[model samples]
Target: MAGKRRKVPHALHSELSEYSSLLRALSTNDTLDVAKRLTESKPRKRKKRTEEESDGAAENEGTAAPSKKRRKRTEDAPVDAESTQNEAAGSSQLPEEEPNGDKPKRVRKRDGWTRWPLLVTDLRVPEFGLDEEIEALVRHCLRNNNPHPTDEDGDSDPEDDAPAWLPHLTQSSSAFLSSLFALLAHHTPARPQVMQDRLNAIDWRMVLDILATCGSVDADVINTVKTRMEAIYGPYDGPAPTRLEARAVAKSRTDAALDEADDAMFVAVRPSKRLPKRVLEDVDSDALDD
Candidate 1:
C-alpha cells in the first residue's frame, strides 16, 4: 500500500533539481528519465485555511463589518511587493533540460611512428614481384668467398692492365643491395658467426656502385646504405676504379674466355688449304701480326 501511494511535498521541485545536480556530478546519464518522471508525478499541494483566519472569523461572528475584518487581516499579514514580483518572474522561467542519451567522449593519446605490421598468416613473399636481376645480385653477394690474406680482388688488382668488367647497376640492384645489407646488419633469423667473414669478403666498391646507380633514392637512405656498407667492408681511403679501368678489365676477361678452348664450347676448324711457306716465313708473319 505504501509503494502504491505517492505524497507531494512543498519543496519537491527544488529536491528534484538537487538530485539532477548530484546525478550529473556522478556521470549517471541513464537515470535522468526516471528523475523526470518522479518530478512530473509529485502530488500538488491543496490550499488550506490558516488557524488565525478561522479564529478571527469566529470572533467577529458577523458583529464587525466585512470591510473592517478585511482591513484587520491585511494589516496582520503584510506582503512585500518586490518579493511577489520576483516570485512571478522566477515561476515564468522554464527549467533547463539535460541531454540524457548522449555518452561521454573518450580522450585518445597522440599517435607516433609505427612499424610495418607483419602477421604470421601473411604471405611469405613480397606483395610486389621482385626483379630477377636483383635476386641474382643478392645471391651472388650472399655466396661465401674463400678468405685471402691480401686484398687481391678485382678492386685491388693494380698490375692488371685491363679494365674491370663491373655489372651495370639498376634500380632493382640498389634495392636488393639495401635489403641484403639490412638483413646482414639485423642478423635476421639468427646471428651466425659466418656473417662477419662473409661481410669482410664483400668488396666496398660494389656497394658504392649500387649507390651511384640509384638516381631516385633519398640522400639519407644513400648515406645509411654507405654507412652499412662500410660497417661490413670496413673504412678505406682507396676508391673504386674508373670507367676506363673497368673497360680494360672487361677486355682481359673476354680474351681469357677466348683463350680457353674447352670452356669456349667451339670446335676448332682447321684450314683446308695449306700455305706452302718456309718455317722462317711463318715466324716472321706471326710476329708481324702480333
Candidate 2:
C-alpha cells in the first residue's frame, strides 16, 4: 500500500514552479500558499520493492551483465584505484536507520516567504464592538478634544478647534474607525448608511484609504480587506457631502426636524447665544423680517 502511493512528481513540481514565477508578478496574496505547496520539489523516497518486482529485477540484472569482450576491455583499462574504492564503498553503503530501526523523519525545507501570513476567515467583527472600541481609542488618543464642543462654546473650545473626527461630524474621534463601523452597519439588521457630512467630504472610505490618510498604513500595501468583505457581501459598492451642497441636504433635514418638533408639545426653544459673525448676520436679518 505504501509502495502504491506515488510521491509528488518532478514534472508537476516544475510546472507549478513556472506558474509561481508568473504569480509572483501579480499583486494579490491570495493564491501564494497553493503555489508554494504545488512547487515543493521534495526528494522522493525510495519505494519498497515487492517480492515479485525484486525477483524480476534480479533476473534482468543477471541477463544485463556486461559481455566478456566488454569486461576484458574494461579490465585492460587502468582504473584509478582511489576512485574505484570510493565508488565501491558508496554503492555498498546501507540506508540510515535509527537505533530502534525507524527511518529518519523527513524535514520539509521551504522558502522563507512560503512560511505564511495565511489567515483567511469569514468571522465578522461585531458592529457594537468596532464602534465602541475605535471610539474609545480615539477618545484615549485625543489631548484637546475631551469634554466635547457643543453648538455653544464654554470659555473656549477644548484647546482643539473641533471635537468631531471629520471636520464637524457625528461620533468617533478617528475617521478611520468611524468609516469601518459605517461599512459594517450596511450588513446588519440596522442597515443604516455611513452617516457623515462635512467640509470637502468625499465618501470613498476603504480601510486602507482612511489608514493612508492618517499615515498609519503605507500607500504601497494595497487593500485586501475589500477582497474578503466583497466575497461575503456580494458587491461592497454602496454609500458623501459639501457645505453649499451640504446646506441643501441640511436644510431639508433641519426643516423636517422643525416640523416634527412643531407637532409635539414644546418644551423650550431659544436662540443660541454663541452664534458666529456669519450666523449673527443671518440671525439679525431673520429678526428684522420677524
Candidate 3:
C-alpha cells in the first residue's frame, strides 16, 4: 500500500535526485552525518580531574608498582603548577589572542594590492624629499629645451641622436614621476574641461616611449601617471597625436618653468606685472546738475 501511494512528480523526482547527487558529492557519501561532513570537528573540552579522583588513581597506581618514575612525577607536580602560574602572569601583560573557535569561511578572492604608484597632490622637495636625479630632470624640462620635447621619428629615432642629457635625466622612479605629474596637474592654467581635452589628445604610447628612455621605468609607473591625469583632468579618448603634440598641450597649460626654492615655495619668473593705469574723470556731479 505504501509503495502504491502516488509517486513524486517526475520534475520533483529529478530535482530530488540532483540534490541527492550534490549532497553525496559534497559529503563524500556521508550524507546522513551532515554535521560531520560539512563542519570541522572542534576539539572537545578536557574534563578536569577532581583531587579525590587523582588520589584514587595514584593509590591504584602505587598499589600496582612504586616505580621511581611515578615518585618523580608526583614530586614535580608542584613545580609544574608554579611554572604554569609564572607563565600565566607573564602572558597577562601581553595582548589577548583573537578568538578562533569558529573556522573562517574559505573564500577565493582576487588580489587587491595595487601595483600603481599612490596618488599625490604635490611634490615639494621639503615634504617629499629632494632627489638629485629628480632635480636634474626638473631642470632639464624647464631649461632651454623645447616646451614639448619630442622627436618626430618617435621611438624609431636613434638613441644616440636623442639629447645626451635626455637619457641621463632621472624621472623613471614611479613615486617621483607620479608626484611630479600631480604637481603639474594641480598647477595647470586651463580649466578642468580644457585640461581633459588636451590630455585626450596626447599620444600615450609615445609618452611611454619617452619615459622609457629615461630609464627602465615600469609600465605601472606610466599607468599611474596616466591614471592621475585622467582622474583630475577627465578621461581623454580622442585620437592619439604625436608625443610632441601631447607635451606641447601640457606645457602650454602648466607653468613648470618657475624654480622652486628649498622651502618648497615656487619662485615665479615675475612676481607681479604692472598694468597701464586708466585716467579718471575729474568732473563733479554738482556742475552737471547746474
Q: Model 1: residues >4 Å from true position, as ranges? A: 1-106, 110-118, 123-127, 132-168, 171-290
TM-scores vs. true structure, each candidate: 0.16, 0.18, 0.15
Superior candidate under lDDT, 2 versus 3: 3
Q: What is the lDDT of residue 246 in candidate 2?
A: 42
Could you tell me the lDDT of residue 43 within candidate 2?
70
lDDT values, one for every candidate: 0.49, 0.48, 0.50
User: For model 2, where is the 10-residue window of minimal lDDT?
Assistant: 195-204
lDDT of 1 by residue, 1-290 (tens): 36765666759977886675564433322322344533555467655556676556655654466469668857888778987678569757956333231323455964321112222332144455445555455445533443342445535533342224323344547676667666444432232564422222123455454434433334456557667756654674433334334545776898887789566577766779987885643357667789
Q: Candidate 2, residues 70-95: lDDT per residue as tens digits?
A: 47757898778887788679757956
Q: What CA root-mean-square deviation does each model show from the true structure?
A: 33.9, 24.4, 31.9
For candidate 3, write residues 1-290 as lDDT tens digits.
36767889999999987776554344322322434533645568666666677666666554555367557766877557787687669868877533332333455974322212222321112445335556555656654455555666445534335455653454445466676455443432233553442222113443554454333345466667667767654675532324435555665556443323333574456668889899987989999899
1 versus 3: better TM-score goes to = 1
Which is the leading candidate under TM-score? 2
Give the Å error, residue 234, model 3. 19
Candidate 1 local lDDT, residue 183:
46
- Candidate 1 local lDDT, residue 89: 91
* TM-score of candidate 1 relative to the true fold: 0.16
